[model samples]
Target: MKASSGYAGVPRWVLAIAIIGALFVVLPLVAMVVRVNWGQLIPLITSKESTDALLLSLRTSGAATLLCIIVGVPMALVLARTRFPGQRIVRSLVLLPLVLPPVVGGIALLYTFGRQGLLKAPMDFLGIQIAFSTTAVILAQTFVALPFLVLSLEGALRTVGTRYEAIGATLGAGPTTVLRRITLPLVLPALVSGAVLSFARALGEFGATLTFAGSLQGVTRTLPLEIYLQRESDPDAAVALALVLVAVAILVVGLAHQASLGNAGGRQRLL
Candidate 1:
């Protein structure tokens, strides 16, 4: 061990900076928790509209996450494991929704799938009116949340090297067999974590859902929308709703963290 020149090899300034940064990050959560009025929490949550919005939020977000899994897992495989001309561009395009403003995303969806949109005639012929409906809520949530699943799964794929898959292929395994048996199991934890996080994000979504789905009661009014509307008429009720969202967010993120850590630990044990 090296001798310290009265500094213990770690400057007090650095420790202070770290503590300050941590406090800054944690203060808002603390504030929200402290501000919540616990006395009326249950009654506030039991309000008809609040319950409706909460259920709608869960249903739509869950549906959107299912859609993400159906579409995103394959795309993640392509982006992480394959190569072609313009491959980098294609990968970047997948992440565009994450960085884009949600309202702008809503407008983009409107232009592409709304009434009188590019495919409007065919969609109308098929009796598919996508805007301002429960279906629209799912679409808006899926549009914003798909990238999260894709990106997380891509990272997991990168971590899980292709060597195992190549060896499986040499062992008389077909592409489908290798993917179903080898690739999916190895990446499942990431996929699950991504799905959970995406569901939480979609549940808390506001701008795009409002713009595309139109806050119709019991149809499209999700928890966030209800909270926004309630703020104008009942501030206490809004705070209670906000607390619920905060609790859900915390639980989701905590589960994601635990799941990711468990996966890493399992992988290490296997190695």
Candidate 2:
């Protein structure tokens, strides 16, 4: 941390760029907030269509976040704690969605889960239909949100390291015991931060969901999808939904920030 009083000799250009970057993120939110029609804000958001969209968004995003926690934790563990041939390639594949366009992801999902997909015969045999349904929304959100969890958990695991687990093992504790008692608790903050990020990402998912889930109201139309639909006919509703999304983003960022601060404080204490 730097002194509160001054820049501590930071270069002007670097500071200017950093300020610009911050403004780029913050300005859009300010613009949306400024344009909100306060008179109809509550009614607009609480309208039947808006409520349905909000509820669907929350449920699907929540489910997606849970899925990320379930899968991402173990995947991060494998990446951080084990090594094998093609490990880098595997990690890169798992994180491909971070860089891949949402439309591309949607297309990939459509091919993989659609009626005539590669595994269609097996899925049909098992009676599992995933594409263009509520399940598809969760899957798409998970695809986009998974990287946040995996990267966050992997960094946490790296920071906590294996020393504690090693000591616990020497003390006759089992692997699961050590993980449950020591490793997980140590990384809980990062896990939480990651979950917040994942949920936020899922909540704001639009492109993949639109491409894969097709924006059926109350079935697959999430907040972002609803906002898009409202944009052309009801601009106020679109702005209202955008503001709601901005609020959710702020909440997620605040929670993640707090978790990061806790993580930093814990590390400082250890130091």
Best by TM-score: 2
TM-score attained by model 1: 0.94
Whole-model lDDT, model 1:
0.90
lDDT string for model 1 (5-91, tens) is 435577778878888999998998888778778898899999899999999999999999999999999999999999899998998
Candidate 2: regions farther than 4 A off = 1-6
Worst 10-residue stretch by lDDT in candidate 1?
A: 2-11
Model 2: colliding residue pairs: none
Considering every candidate listed, which one attains the maximal lDDT?
2
1-271 per-residue lDDT for model 2 (tens digits): 9554426677777788999999998898888888999999999999999999999999999999999999999999999999999999999999999999998999999999988887799999999998889999999999999999999999989987899889999999998999899889888889999999999999999889988889888999999999999999999999998998888888898999999889878767766
Q: Each model's TM-score?
A: 0.94, 0.95
For candidate 2, the TM-score is 0.95
Clashes of each: 0, 0
Question: CA shift at 94, candidate 2, in angstroms?
Answer: 0.7
